[model samples]
Target: MATILKRASKGKAGYGKIQFCGEQARRDGLQYFWVDTCCIDKSNACYVYLPDVSQSSSVLADNSNESWESFRKSEWFRRGWTLQELIAPASVDFFSREEVLLGNKTSLEQDICETTGIPATALRGSALSDFSVAERMSWTECRETTYKEDKAYSLLGIFDVYMPLIYGEGKDRALRRLREEIDKASRGTSLFKREDFSVSFSLSDVSDVEHFVARKIELVKIHKALGVDGSRRVVVLHGLGGIGKTQLTVAYAKRHKDDYSGIFWLNIKDENSLKQSFVKVAKQISREHPLALRLSNVDTNENLDDVVDAVKEWLSLLNNKRWLMIYDNYDSPKLPGKTDPTVVNIREFLPELY
Candidate 1:
């Protein structure tokens, strides 16, 4: 193993495995091949997972439960380094010791999670910060490292923090240093620090969430559309009136409430109702930020349009991203020759989303 490692490092050795990897890279139309001896940005790299599971005929014949259990119990899964390699990559192709193709990460996610006790969300590439520090730490409890200090050092990618590696620091000191760096990285660094379910939220109702059946496909679409790309995402739930559009939106908000800093709902049934909702939003903001009271001067003497403009400005604050705004009952978008008093131009009420 040490000789193989040495040959892999030099990239010019007579090792058959290294030559095979190079051939695979060429077959895939690539010039570079990276091994997981060290961590890089795995999100950008395709990881070829070579687990040391035997490809014996018995293991292959029946695809039996025992065979799968043996696959899960491979030494590769027990290594501390493989944890990040499994979770960080956007793509992973698994192969057995005999170079037989097994499956990809997405295809074999359930088996991997059963072995590792990692939630499918994290394995599916949800934000690491979406998980708590304790939960992230727990993923390493079962894995082992060669050197005691390496136990802590291997976790740098998991916590998304970095520290200089000192080989002789001992495991305790290394862990203490890792924890200190994690604390420093966490302090005031979040744009939205509100606890789960503690964000300033004004939604339709909680009662609807109880009876709501999961709209799995729609939810997945919403998540994919509004990916973590730091851009404005708008998802319109259009359907016949009274066909549970409101319920769907409510369910989405409640399910993903923690994913945002704030969740605000607007009643766009009509122009008058939209203005009233904006006034309510202004009041909500004023309670948190005293400075917002100046912008939202929502007195009877003040024009409603000014209040709307002020609330929009507050929502448009540069630092306040990850806010979920739902414009409900938008059945009366203004159009040519539409003289209805209830008609509204929703564009006027929307904030400039960054």
Candidate 2:
């Protein structure tokens, strides 16, 4: 590993890396390849000093009896330039001092975790975004960089954000900028589309999420189906009660409320509730939608069906606006019998969008 590192840092790129990378990219049907070591910006590079193991450091030798430290503490481990090389790659292979075939990061993860103090999942090359800010920061707790600015710059790929080089800025400010960029990235639109159900979304509703794990992957699939690609624009999650479907949706809304223009949760647990919720929602939609108020002529004599029909009409329109509607707890088609012409099933009230 040390020999290869030395050669990689040398003035000449003599390892046949260019041809090898080009061939590998071609085999993978890719247009190009990127090698960080080959194209490093030496202007922003950090240096590491390796010592001869056979001869101890003269300063340590001169002092009284002292314990020997292995090359694990070498500058290579501490240099800021090396952290990304260790982490950002999908997989990293390690070779012995004799250059014999050893193993890749996955094949020897336990040792890597014990040595580096990084979590096994991260060492296995999980997306940096999958881990929290604190978890990512802890990976570099003891690592070092020659320039204060490189400490933050080194983590650019880890956080998956790009900022202009500001070498003179102190480490604190640079790190601050890095975190700001990460926060901006975290705010990117998620698939959890929410409809305005006559009430503002409350994070408190999902505050009890400690006991419930986030079903983000499932929610993402549903989000993509309902929100993306402009096809199959409607989705229904049908299952027996107490299956965590509602909680999963609430968790998605709480986590990604900022991504959507609006979020609406309809309590279609029963027909009366569904109709009432729809009428209430129509009044709210009337403020923004041109057709809603005209259709919802809420005279004292107006029937409940009139309001529901008006609300459905407002929702079915094809517009540039984006919103998510959850027809929650739709366990049965039969509405709780109430008025003269009872609400029979869900198909009757739903919007008619293709």
Candidate 3:
């Protein structure tokens, strides 16, 4: 048998509204009201049917369970729309208790109606007979229970059951965090340069390479140790293209990004390109050009040495603060039968301090 139960609380104001609906039903000339409080034996906690009585049976005298249900067939359930209009005093308090017991940490002021897509006013009343109170109780317990208790399965196991009802649009945020964790595990190199240095891709996106994770971890340790050292060290990460060298440095920069005061990534593919990249990095770090007009005086008149000196001076000023200079793709030759001047100059600029 399908049963509907309402949590009743005495001395509550909302229950009076249910009584108002019942009075309206009586004024509308309805014969009987299927009010659970009067219809069911609350003392015994059992479902009992009530029968009808004639005019000889006064309404006050017909207070027994047998008189009410017999007076109205389906109409007993329909009188004044009590099924939709009745207020259950315990509805809000039950959900509040469930939320606390479940440890959801959601605010009581939060519009659960908006989040769950249930009408706020409808929930204010105890009119939801179609919903199962047992199911709600189980859901509350499942959410509040920690993974430590259910060790055999992860929290995802519990989430799968109630996700449909509980998570409306908020499911996306949970999925996004999950994807980030999966990516961090799979990539082995926590390096992705978005607006935030936090890794963004999943493990499936990273290439399979031996010692990739180890190499990145070692780089992080080196970066940390270098940060502590009063003197700056220009650690050049060099390897064949696509050997994951750039990826390693980028990952290192991202991991220890907070430790360093500033980080500059320069792609030194050619002489002119390298100079432009350095100027951009210089501007980002220093925020103002020390020799702005001189550098912008003429297009071809700008000497590579001067630009390199400016970058060196900027690095020098950051002696009290830690900084990272990432020189990417520094494999090109400067001229015919000549080594890249940019690489040679970078080494010269990064002087070892005593």
Best by lDDT: 1
Number of colliding residue pairs in each model:
0, 7, 4
Candidate 2 RMSD computed on C-alpha atoms after optimal superposition onto the true structure: 18.2
Candidate numbers, best lDDT first, in rank order: 1, 2, 3
What's each prediction's TM-score? 0.49, 0.37, 0.32
**Candidate 1 error regions (>4 Å):** 1-14, 46-51, 56-61, 191-354
Model 3 misses residue 340 by how many Å? 7.7
lDDT by residue for model 1 over 132-226, one digit each (tens)?
66567667767899998888888888888889999998876787788688768888877223322123666643237467686789888887887
Task: Encode model 3's per-residue lDDT on 309-353: one tens digit a residue.
Answer: 665664564333455566777775344567634543445445234
List clashing residue pairs in candidate 1. Answer: none
Candidate 1 whole-model C-alpha lDDT, 0 to 1: 0.72
Local distance difference test values of all predictions, in order:
0.72, 0.58, 0.40
Over 1-354, each residue of candidate 2 has an lDDT whose tens digit, in order, gives: 334545575456434443444444466466544554632332221111233222234433443323223333345556666767766566564433323223456765665676677788776556566665545665676778889888788888766689998989887678778867765776644321222322234434222446888666897887677763433256877777877877888877777676564566677877888777776666555433322334435542357787777766665655424556667777656645645344447777777674
Q: Which consecutive 10 residues in model 1 have the weakest lDDT in total?
A: 191-200
